[model samples]
Target: MIEIRNLTKSYGRKNALDGLTLSLGHGVTGLLGPNGAGKTTLLRCLATTLAYDSGRVEAFGLDPSQASQRTALRRRLGYLPQDPGSYPHFTAFDLVDYVAILKELTGREHRHREVRRVLAEVDLTDQARTKVRKLSGGMRQRLALAQALLGDPELLILDEPTVGLDPEQRMRFRALVSRLGESRTVILSTHQTEDVAALCERVVAMDRGRVVFDGTPGGLAATAAGQVWLSDKPPARSQLFWRTADGRYRTLGDRPPGAEPAEPGVEDGYLLLEVAA
Candidate 1:
């Protein structure tokens, strides 16, 4: 449903997105990257919040750079930014209702009905009347999510949606996102490997402002297949080595003579990509 070609964006002397090209179809696609991997930059560009320096970006078969087309695309798109601003004095219900209006839900009865429905979807119906300042961080995140789901947009762009969520909250979010992807396209940009593994059918890994890997979760994991090994101690010559919870050292790179081959995971492949780049 989305197509990007040679996308380039810069900030001062640095290039945030360089020669990035990607195409997404129906279903959930996970965007995995490090802090400066241009994940947020790409999301903003797609949301039409930031303009790219060059390249073509098409959403639902229309170019977003054009004013009229951008407005039309926004009508069918839902965006949950990294930090969705809030008014502490506004209650959860009030905040979502305001956003509904911005989305052009004009009729009083219809807007109210949609606000309540989305609040319930995010499991915030009981806290509908609670002030934003009184809610927990996780609650606030869900409140933001409720606003994004207001119009039931065709394309959902979520950036770090699980940041403040607890384990249970994150699990609920995964289930909700998975369900949403059944009929529409969901683009999830996150640092959480497990989230991608559980909720996405396809994965895109980026580094240095460009996509380095685009494939299935298993295919990404296979990038590090025979490169990862486990041993009692950290391997001195390994490119990347870390101690696991089981008190063994999992190393990526040239295996030591006594190191046993260990199954590769999403994180392993991601780290390997970082090192390779």
Candidate 2:
């Protein structure tokens, strides 16, 4: 388990994370929020990639501030930074191999075996020898994922892992992560709400660098229970729609008091949560 107590990050007078605390148990937890909502900041602090001004962080039963403990924790965790870049002219295979050594996952032959395994897992075997600069944006992301899988980590922290993939590739990646979470912790920070509803058993929603909600998708949808309605037409004062074959406009909004409730969607639930904040 991962425990974050009284976590905080300050950039001079500005607060990136304010008194954040959370306990991460085993399973897939969607870190849901908009950009600059401290999702990356929190992930970076957990990965020990960046330092926090104040907080106590314990990961996999080790304190991240201690050198030995930090080393141990890193071995058990796989992190993919928001921006995964490498020096120009380095081939995908070459860079992955280098990361394997840095992780110290194995020696010569074993390292080669591990590198080849992850490269194939990320579907980059065909372009393993291709230079990063020459690869497409999606391919570079796959290479980054390859490196993250090098150590077969127990905890995987993925920030927007499917951003560049095509629909097919994204589905494949999501399936792989879902499988990985069965035995380990997979904390995924993403702006994609569909990904959360599909892959996460629970979600941590943040706003302005603070956790505004944490619960299951169903629970989140429940937030809009009485505040949603389906309208035959949009507000009369607003512009009219072209209508979709059916004459009724099928618009959605908060139902008026004493009126029947409308079925709420995840998007509607999310909007309600955001507005309430």
Candidate 3:
């Protein structure tokens, strides 16, 4: 579990996180936000990879601001950053093994077992021996995930973990994350609304560095209830209308005369929230 209160972080004059307060328990919670919405900043703060300008952050009853507690918190959490960076020369196994050691896996044989286990979990077993530079983008992303899964931490912070993944791999990741969430807390930050709809039990939307909405996936979709309508053509003067796959115009705004009310989904509500913000 994690708790935050009035957490604020800034980069010079820009506030990355502004008076953010949140509590997370065991389950998959999707963080939905557009660029510059502070999702990554919040995740980094939770991971203790970045320090905030103000407020408190505690995970599993330990304060991450303290040196000793920060170490302890790190031991109980796994983080996959937005840009995991490149390890060009290291093989997939080596990359994970390096991180496992950092996570304090001291025994060689045991560490190797863990490295292979995590690699397999990410479906990168076949490329375990391949060099990082030679792996495909998706394979490299999975390799980053392998390092994050090194110790089976209680909390997992994933920022754009599905980036570059094919549909099949994304489904595999959803299944794995869903299974993990049964016992621990997983905070998944992504732009992919479909993933949130499919995997997250709770959804949190942020805008301009603050929490805008927090609720269940269905509840999020319901935020757009009665606001979404379908028509053969977009409503004149409507700013939020898009062509759908069915050749109909799906518009989110005040209803147009004769337009049919369409069922709202997670993305529809999220978009409406963004526009309002």
Local accuracy of candidate 2 as per-residue lDDT tens digits, 135-205: 88888888898888887899899988888888888887888888889999999888788888888898899
Candidate 2 TM-score to native: 0.90
True-structure Cα RMSD, model 1: 1.0
> Tens-digit lDDT track for model 3 on 208-273?
789999999999999999999999877897989999898999999899767999999999999999
Q: Which stretches of candidate 2 lie over 4 Å from their true place?
A: 236-253, 256-262
Regions more than 4 Å wrong, model 3: none
User: Model 2 scores what on Cα lDDT?
Assistant: 0.82
Candidates ranked by lDDT: 3, 1, 2
Residue by residue across 111-227, what tens digits does model 1's lDDT show? Answer: 999999999988999999999999999999999999989899899999999999999989999999999999898998999999988989999999979999999999999999899
Q: What lDDT score belongs to each candidate, Candidate 1 first?
A: 0.93, 0.82, 0.94
Task: List the candidates' TM-scores in order.
Answer: 0.98, 0.90, 0.98
- Summing lDDT over every window of 10 consecutive residues in candidate 3, give the lowest-scoring window: 141-150
